[model samples]
Target: MRDPDAFYPGSRTREEWLAECAFDQACGGATITPGGAPLPGTEQAEQQPAEPAPAPAAPDPTTATIEDVAEFAPDPPQVVGEPDGIGVVGMPTNFVVDATEHTVTGDIFDIPVTVRFTPVSYVFDYGDGTRRETTSPGTSWQDLDVPQFTATDTSHSYGEPGEYEVGVTIRYAAEADAGGGWFPIAGLLELTAPTTVIRIVDVDTALVERTCAEDPSGPGC
Candidate 1:
């Protein structure tokens, strides 16, 4: 008869080899008996079925709405100029204004998001039936190195004397970021600043022969 020890390659005995083959069959692998015959259940164990993977998560519906994006809209712009009053009638009054860039960060539907706002254009309403639009925020006459009443991009002259309600509307553009590159929002937004009341009056000039220093408040001294 052929020797059973020659069928196995290792130095294990017959009983040890049988135990190893039984362990391999339990672990979903093929097994062979000491006599070189395949085990009855080894093939079925080796072909055990696999479990299906879990499905992916669904997207949030709130993040796709307009109201969600509008929540990140910028606040109203601040109007900068002489708060007390302005110059007299026919004078070149500079309507200076400025708007700084701002950022808002928060979560949208459990997803982190960031929004940025920047001023793009300025519309000035002088309250005298005249309106002007410009890219600059305008500067004072002294800053522009020019004399008063000189025509400038943002300077306006009051034709008559009265109280004018000066107001400005600022246009802002928005951009969004969600762990990716920045992209522009669908539409532009406009914000109007509080109206400013300024008094405009006509100045009268007089010429006198005597000096005003001696007369104190006499005549047009």
Candidate 2:
């Protein structure tokens, strides 16, 4: 029998034939040169360097203004006291107010940002034609090492018996941080505390000779 390889002299092998067919199909049946090289234009296209991947877009600016910082300011101040509802005429009543720090976080122009609100001062309105402003919330008598019913920096005395409303306003300073160091925000913002009412009454005293133990129901025991 004749050898299969001798059937076609000067013809390509089966692998070469399949490869040429695949190339023809890929190039839409375009003609290939003797060494199976692509056409001129096709060779140029294959040799051309690919464009560098587009650089990632730069991040947007994180600029902020006082008004923008104000948007994240702290809530109203909280009033702290012991006898929150009662007071005595001609007596000293201690009052204190404070506000907790708050962190405000959000996006500005697609860039993340953070701002903090810090309390600077508190303004107290006694609602009886008297007002006081303090840099720090005053401490209690025990904490201040002072005696009870004594006048203090944050204490008030009532001259007449009546009901009075008390309130406080907190002022906050803002600072912004956006990938860089924190910077103070211009201007200040204020928030008012809820109104609180106190009833003031007068007290009278009398001296008795008998001891409170001797007279369980004495007039001024």
Candidate 3:
């Protein structure tokens, strides 16, 4: 209950206020003259108890923490294309090959080469002693080298950094198999080597065919 003499700011207790209003003589609860009769209808009105303060709303369910904020920070660094944009044919030029952001990143990339000679045999030499001997239409990194043919895919990496001339030499042998079936081979292009841990490229031209005789006496021998 609030003390009326205490200089408090707000209203007094609900009960006291109600009583003050109910028994005030002018508002009608006083007794009349001689008979001491009550003035009228003002007996303290029934006071309703204050509604229990609403239970403090349950603290919002949450686990906000440093880890939670860190989890949603931002993105990490990234390099979209090949390192320095290095490119290769069927072999590595400078020994070093462009490593896919992933191969170096654990992702592997495979390129294909198709060989065609009217009706003879064409081989894909992976430059690692392994030869991909195939009919006309064929796959290089297949069989993995043996009586059949070297698999269509080969893997190699460079040791150091430097300008390396990597390329493929395609030779059209006069079919050591066929009595006379040959064609001009190629692979005489040059380009800058990539700067990745390990990169690979494919080519389709010269190798070992140094003499003019190896240059196909004609077009299709």
Residues 1-221, candidate 3: write the lDDT tens digits: 43222110123332332233322212211112222222236334446557554443222101111121222222222211122323344322211122111101111011121122111222333333444433322322222233222222323233333333322222111100011121111111111222122233442455453555777674433
Tens-place lDDT digits, model 1, residues 5-117: 22232444434443343223222121232333233354333343475544433443222333456677666655544423666777777677767677898766677777766
**lDDT scores in order:** 0.59, 0.61, 0.25
Error of 1 at 125 (Å): 0.7
Candidate 1 stretches greater than 4 Å from native? 1-68, 80-84, 108-110, 145-150, 210-215
The TM-score leader among the candidates is: 2
* Model 1 alpha-carbon miss at residue 108, Å: 4.1
Each model's TM-score, in the order given?
0.62, 0.65, 0.17
Error of 2 at 201 (Å): 1.5
Comparing 2 with 3 on lDDT, the higher-scoring candidate is 2
Candidate 2 local Cα displacement, residue 101, angstroms: 2.8
Over 4 Å off, model 2: 1-63, 211-214
Error of 2 at 164 (Å): 0.9
lDDT of 2 by residue, 1-221 (tens): 43232111125432343233221322112122233323335434334358665544344222244466666676676675545567788998888776777898976555677877766667778878898887666677788877777777777888999988888887665555656544444445678998778788899978887888999888877
